[model samples]
Target chain A: MNGEAPFVPDERDRALMLATQEGLPLAVRPYHALAERLGWAPEEVFARLARLHAVGVIRRIAAAPNHYALGYVANGMSVWDVDDERVDELGQWLAAQGEVSHCYRRPRALPLWRYNLFAMFHARERAEVERAVAVAAVRLAACFPGAVRAHEVLFSSRILKKTGVRLDF
Target chain B: MRERRPATLDDLDRQLLWALQDDLPLCERPFAVLATGLGVSEEEVLQRLRRYLAEGIVTRFGPFFQVERMGGAFCLAAMAVPEERFDEVTVAVGAFPQVAHNYRREHALNMWFVLAATRPEGIVETARAIENAVSLPVWLFPKEREYFVRLRLRP
Candidate 1:
């Protein structure tokens, strides 16, 4: 099964995602209601979801929050270019930082873009963020000498949408 | 810092993730409900989840909310840090509470990280802080237009 094709969602799984994504009803036994509407037993619906998750078809099923409502107003994306040998070492360290929420490495764009490290951070104020970044830079330098080359910070001005996958079932 | 690696997930792991992606049951016996539907016992469901988490198959297993909806300002920022100072730069950026995620891409402005603040001014202030700390001019690249921002893990 390791090399088998990824499990594709059938009509039933697709319908469940569509209904839930559109806006799950805020009533008691929402899943039961969803099952009723879809003409499936509640247990069966839940079971199907579990199976989907187990196969890596879905990442998680939980309440995605509205960060703005929670007072996390300022957000930005920061990237860096470090020594290839130490990139993973630095990446792991950055990922552990509370301020740095999302950290990943993607292929560089070349000539113009040569950096290879990235992280995300949210704050209540820009000044606080600046202070945090400054400290992070110093710490990173201490950990790996001459690893960081260049870095740029971009702030997201607007939020288009932050939803899960829109698969074609 | 640890080595980087991709996660290896199986069919069962994918099903669990799909279910959790939508929303975990909000009940006293949520696992029970999930297990019954999957034709497995609650213990089995929980055990597999725990194992997947331990193996780093799933980055996180909790709520992912819309920051702006909660009355917050967020932006995507990138900095041009040289390879020599990459580690130092990341450490400096990661110290802040607002910094949520950071990525390294192949670009002049390589180092990219996300910043969020409760107030609008916080955005500029944070950018400036990073600028002074890194001794590099940090360019604030706020999203002017967003065509798409969804992660389709499965192809």
Candidate 2:
């Protein structure tokens, strides 16, 4: 059996995740502060974080702005039913656009759901998002004519729950 | 529900938001490194970041882990609930630890949420449990392929 083995973080790695899960310290020397707290050298903390990043465990160390707080009140999940053969290509084009925050190719659920491509976009106003999506559709038609069949935008009305995943070591 | 208003920000704060979206360097003085690029003092950068967090302008600031790379699974699941039971169903669904984020979208499938689990089977199990709790069929739309996913936002 050639099942891919799961990556189990070592004690130090687990500690690192736990420490930075909430967020990294806002000190002048954040790594040094982490090292002092974790009882490791500053170099060791940096090396471990670098290794995690290299191995694709950490996507990035960056700030996530709250869309609502930034005047982007409308969050639209624009989905499309594109030609199966060219869906991936069109999806890549959509993803490259700055307006699209998240784009993915998901399976259609037959009669209930017909959209296979999902692109999430945010805007200060719902109309702005719709206008931008229309512009994008025009561009897609020009580049990949007849590739996109139908599309719809689903705006999130409320956030029922928002939280991060917690892993038990 | 908490009220949300756009925070008034200066040009420096705007620039800082744009700069912070990019990956910070792995160095001894990372904030200082960012300060140099932003042409501001390190203390200023730190102060603004702290304020942003405190004011909920920035949801999080740190390393984003790709759980899938660590043998975890995430599934985007949705459900169509009767309007009367929507609130009750939301609480039942949110009770599951595996449900990372839930959103109410304007669609027939009005309730959507993401499930993140340590193992792939955990997702299936949690979905089954949620279905049992809510008595609604959960439509799991796992990503067949990812084209792009950049979570940065312009302030």
Candidate 3:
């Protein structure tokens, strides 16, 4: 997923994005509402969105829940020092789990940082998250014995800031 | 920060949140489509969504863009600010528009943040600017590969 090619949005697409980048309209017929604003046919609006989604530009149109507000108080970033030869395999296995929110293979900053696999887990309690991590570790060991050397779960204490990504264009 | 009781959601709320985790249909009335699936009226769905947004339960409702596909880049970076200057350094770090989500975690590298930039080089440039401003070395961990990224969460 990190090797995705570039997609330069043309003028029309740019205009379409600029119109709804803040958010999709809340009206009963949001596409039609957007069409009215953009002075384009409702069909065109839907078509553009469909095309963007098909090409991987837009991942999806959905509600992003505030985990903390929804009672997911424990946010742990579980990092693992797995075999470099099979880190990707381990990452895929971990990422497929329902509890792993985000998983990726990152570079290790050695000595101080030897973990290359990062998986984020969220739960209502710290203990629950810890247990989940332990279970994952055990399962990983079973899948590939001696593959994982060490792991640690870093729990976030506070959210200093969390404004979602924004693009001027 | 305001504290809300954990697991206070009713069944309807849970169902609605779970339903929304899937990709919303690209139709004239996306919410209406979702409402039908949940056996509720379009108006009710909209009302609940509005309430959730107003109450801070839902942070955002819209398209989830893959910035990398749009010629942008994001990196997870960390800094270890001294105990005495954590607050001051946080303000300095937050000043950057590229710094997206910043979190305070318990570790030697206590401060972790994600930087989103229009181009790949922008991430490095922003990190350097942050280092100069905070007078601390910022360690970046760019993803070599993404196994999976769940855009939505079920509470």
Candidate 4:
């Protein structure tokens, strides 16, 4: 799906997204805590959250580890130039890979930018990240010559700033 | 709980991380369920999570929703920041509240970031502001489409 206004936000979903972006309180009953704060029953909050996850609006209800803290200092944003027709399959293939954290197909800015598929890889060392990229390169080469055009990985040198997307108000 | 450095991920810690990354079961007792399956007590699960949270190992532990679905806007923007002014431009761009997920990548488009705003037009305005401040051309690559966006780093 394009990053557009695809889903209609009901009142409950709005409230849930508004609250949980700060993060769920680390308590024995986080849903209960949310219910108390938002003036909804714990069951309703839980069920609605479940529905959000089911519909793919909520990507996950899990812990997000900081790679830096986990000693994964190197992060490579690998971009691939694959045949438009075959990108969907390649993206799905990359998504299934444990090394590729994020895989997406964006509009290719031709002439200047030739890549379409973007997959991110993380590691504690550059060598490890290089190896991962090398494997991807070889795999891409195995496909038809024009099917996989070119690939490049842009390793982030520093995180000038980073925070999750949240509603300001 | 015993003391461990930031780099070290003990046996229990690794298991806890794997649980958190892949499938943190959406139940009343997510920790309890994880503990039961991983052969640990609920208290231990919670304790490790708290530690992970405190130490910044885990950035967020909750439901992640799409910003666009809720009326917010986000787009990926990149710029070719000269090496001489790399750090300067980084700090200047990072100062904006609308900008998040900024990075210095190894490419001609060295500076990359995602700009998120409460409104759609705000994203464009933020991009312009970045260009003016850095005195560099800002390329806006709003996702014409999206195939997948998931991050599950194996511990």
Q: Give DockQ: model 2.
A: 0.65
Candidate 4 lDDT over residue span B45-73, tens digit each: 88888988887788678776565654667
Please, what are the lDDT tens digits per residue for candidate 3 over residues A1-169? 4456788777888788768766778889888998999999988888889988998878888887777887888899999999999998999999987778899999999788999999999887999999999999999999989999999999998888766676545
Off by over 4 Å in 2: A1-8, B149-151
Summarize candidate 2's per-residue lDDT along A1-169 as a digit string, tens digits. 1145656677899899888877888888988988888889888898899988987778799887777788888989999999999999999999988778889999999999999999998888999999989999999999999999999899998878766565533
The candidate maximizing lDDT is 2
Q: Taking the true A–B contacts (Cα pairs closer than 8 Å), what share appears in each candidate?
A: 0.06, 0.79, 0.75, 0.58
Per-prediction DockQ? 0.05, 0.65, 0.66, 0.46
> Clash totals for all models, in order?
166, 0, 0, 0
lDDT per residue (tens digit) for residues A23-105 in model 4: 88777766788889999888898888888787667777888777776677878999988889888878777777667777777
Tens-digit lDDT track for model 3 on B24-96? Answer: 8987788989999989999998988888877878767788776788888889999988999998998898888
On DockQ, the candidate that comes out on top is 3
Better by DockQ, candidate 3 or 2: 3
Per-residue lDDT for B111 in model 2?
95
Which 10-residue window in model 3 chain A sums to the lowest lDDT? A160-169
Quality of candidate 1's docking, in CAPRI categories?
incorrect
Candidate 2 C-alpha lDDT tens digits along B37-132? 989999999999999998888878888777787788888999999999998998999888888788899999999999987677888888999999
CAPRI verdict (incorrect, acceptable, medium, high) for model 2: medium
Candidate 4 C-alpha error for residue B134, in Å: 4.0
